[model samples]
Target: MGFSTTHLIIFLVIIIVIFGTKKLRNIGSDLGGAVKGFKDGMKDGTDRAADASAAPAQQVGTAGTAAKETIDVEAKTKV
Candidate 1:
């Protein structure tokens, strides 16, 4: 035996009778929101990995403002 269009039509009718049209629409919208949230979470995870890989080159107290602070302190100690 083979499935045909009539079988699908009857199944659809049964679904509509059981759930009504409004409930089906709400279910579709909720499924769409869940898919969107999953995609956004995947993107955030990739961005965090990239930031972590590039973190070691930028030292906090090894140059620029920190170096000036060390020099100033040494000069003050001699006065």
Candidate 2:
């Protein structure tokens, strides 16, 4: 059977008695910090991906323009 509220309370009390409040508090804060770091890393990765996508578009645009100019020059020379 699943743990009832009374069972959960008793379990929590036993854990507190064993670890004490200070240790439990430290553990909770460490867990929170880990979660925060994970979120920040994900945001940084998403920003980098956005920047990388934008750079390629600009490079392709310039490359295309240069190719067009070269083709025009070749056509003029052929005349």
Candidate 3:
């Protein structure tokens, strides 16, 4: 049969015994922080993408900095 509430409780107790509450708490906090950071980074990236797509003529963050100059050159074969 599938695991019941009692079985799940026992499994959790065993895990707690193997890794004490303090260690588990630290691990949980670290995981939470990593997830939060990842979400923030994704949001920032999405905002930048939206800005870029919204205006093809003006790049994002152009209000603060000068426009970048571009150059083109053909690649040559190495000797």
Tell me each candidate's RMSD, in Å, in order: 4.3, 6.7, 8.4
Candidate 1 lDDT, 18-79, residue by residue in tens: 99999999999999999999999999999989988777656653567776666555547643
Which candidate comes out best when scored by TM-score? Answer: 2
lDDT ranking from best candidate downward: 2, 1, 3
Quantify all predictions' global Cα lDDT against the true fold: 0.86, 0.93, 0.86
Weakest ten-residue segment in model 2 by summed lDDT:
70-79
> How many pairs collide in each candidate, listed in order?
0, 0, 0
lDDT of 2 by residue, 1-79 (tens): 9999999999999999999999999999999999999999999999999999899888987997888667455547643
Q: Which residue pairs collide in model 2, if any? A: none
Query: Residue by residue across 1-79, what tens digits does model 3's lDDT show?
Result: 8999999999999999999999999999999999999999999999999987888666546744653443334545557
Deviation (Å) of 21 in candidate 1 = 0.8
Q: Pick the candidate with the highest lDDT.
A: 2
- Candidate 3: pairs in clash: none
Of candidates 2 and 1, the better by TM-score: 2
Over 4 Å off, model 2: 57-79
Q: TM-score for candidate 1, please give it.
A: 0.68
